[model samples]
Target: MQQSIMSTLPLLLLLLFSSLFPAPSHAWGIHGHLIVCQIAQGRLSDAAAAAVRGLLPSYAGGNLSSLCSWADGVKLRYPWSAPLHYIDTPDHLCSYTYDRDCKDEDSFRGRCVAGAINNYTSQLLTYDATSPSTQYNLTQALLFLAHFVGDIHQPLHVGFTSDKGGNTIDVHWYTRKTVLHHVWDDNIIKTAENDYYGEGVAEFVDALMQNITGEWSQRVPGWEECSKNQTTCPDTYASESIAAACDWAYKDVTEDSLLEDAYFGSRLPVVNLRLAQGGVRLAATLNRIFS
Candidate 1:
């Protein structure tokens, strides 16, 4: 009995320490959201640029990318915003129908990520810098749209209902005890930025922009599908993520899965496309709103 108590003491202490310290809560990881925001900033129209300049001076220097992670930073104070990060679908069905899914009990009249995107977007359309309340709403709305766009693109954010979007399924990247969601959220992007684009974040963003060739860089007009009365459009984006999550993110994944080069190599293109689409679509949304 003494030996048993002694054996468990270390684990008890470890649990206490871990609970006190706690790992950082990352949404789309910092650099992931930054990359998407940077791309959108690069693609913003002149009107959109002017609007961003006026609304976001509270950031480090009015840089649009500065506010990209604002929603994550505030998630603690506003617990309600947490569900804005992901949309859940039923297990193994491998498809998204927003009407059937996307609604959670905690949601405000069934507001999920897609619904949040649409709701906030309409607020941006009537942005008023003069009124303090309007200014505050505008800031929050912009932050939500920026973060949600990146979030929805992450395949796992539109993931299975069973695993809390892969958060419950344990896995590891090399030696780190993480889960499948973190692999999609941080590991892959971290690997790409650190290993492939070793020149640091700014350089990496520049390279990513320069690498955007073929149809990836092409601008699409009227690309804000969530504008006005339309709800199905954002669902389409969620559907794309759900499909990718089922077909790719869940492939061969298990609790003991060890992620490495092969995993990153196969999924890098998907990551890039998601980022590109997110950036372009974000620019499209801003263009329409601030036009």
Candidate 2:
């Protein structure tokens, strides 16, 4: 009996650790979030920049990018926030509607990523409220807004519900095994950094910044436009993501499919475009909020 109990100790410890730190389902990895926030901080209006600086904690050193992944980090502490990272659209629909699909598994409306974006945008809008009773934590609102904006741009974040945004669809990214969702979340970005950017995220960000001003300059104004002059337009971002999920992410792929150079080369442009749009729109939303 003593020998058996001792043998089970390692198994019990493994279970405890696994329960404490479950695998993450974040939309974009840390590098992706950092890239988006860095781009956004550089484009902030003078007033917006000052407001951001004031809202950020001193430990952040006024660099919004440094804490862009704060929302993902706090998921274990804030379990209720897990559902706000993505919208699980109906299988094969290739479309998104706030009224139709923006809810959690429990059918709570306005509980999806788009809804989170709207909620945070509204909270941050009260930055200058004359009333002193504003209870909203504007700092948290900013971090969540920044993170969800990056989340909403990831195509798989608005993917088919059957696969839980591709989390269930196993695939091979080259020789390594991973899921479709993780492919979008981290693998593609990691490959880009290693192969093209010398394994440096800052270099990847600089390249995207140049494209924002050079290759993608003409179309950026359209990306920043919000219907009816809304402060932020997450629905548009979500819709684009679903479309891209169908056209690029879920297209011609299946369980155990091997994704290699063909997949990477075709999808990298879409990834780049989405990351750029997330950054630009985040900046635009902040500029509107603080103006």
Name the top lDDT candidate. Answer: 2
Q: What CA root-mean-square deviation does each model show from the true structure?
A: 10.8, 8.8
Q: Which ten residues in a row are the worst by lDDT in model 1? A: 215-224
TM-score of each: 0.83, 0.91
Query: Where does candidate 2 stray beyond 4 Å?
Result: 1-23, 129-133
lDDT of each: 0.75, 0.89
Count of backbone collisions within predicted model 2 = 0
> What is the alpha-carbon lDDT of model 1 when measured against the actual structure?
0.75
Pairs that clash in candidate 2: none
Summarize candidate 2's per-residue lDDT along 1-291 as a digit string, tens digits: 574355445434434554567547567998889999999998999999888877766556778898787778667667889999999999998999999999999999999999999999999988963332247867778889999999999999999998999999999999999999999999999999999999999999999999999999999899889999899999999999999999999999999999999999999999999999999999999999999
**lDDT (10s digit) by residue, model 1, range 1-291:** 574355445434544553555435546887888988998998888888888776653333556676676677665556787777888888999998867887875545446888888878877878764544423357667778988988888899888888988989988787788889988888888888888778377776776677664454454433445545452257778888988988788888888888777777888888877777777677777877887
Query: What residue pairs clash in candidate 1, if any at all?
Result: none
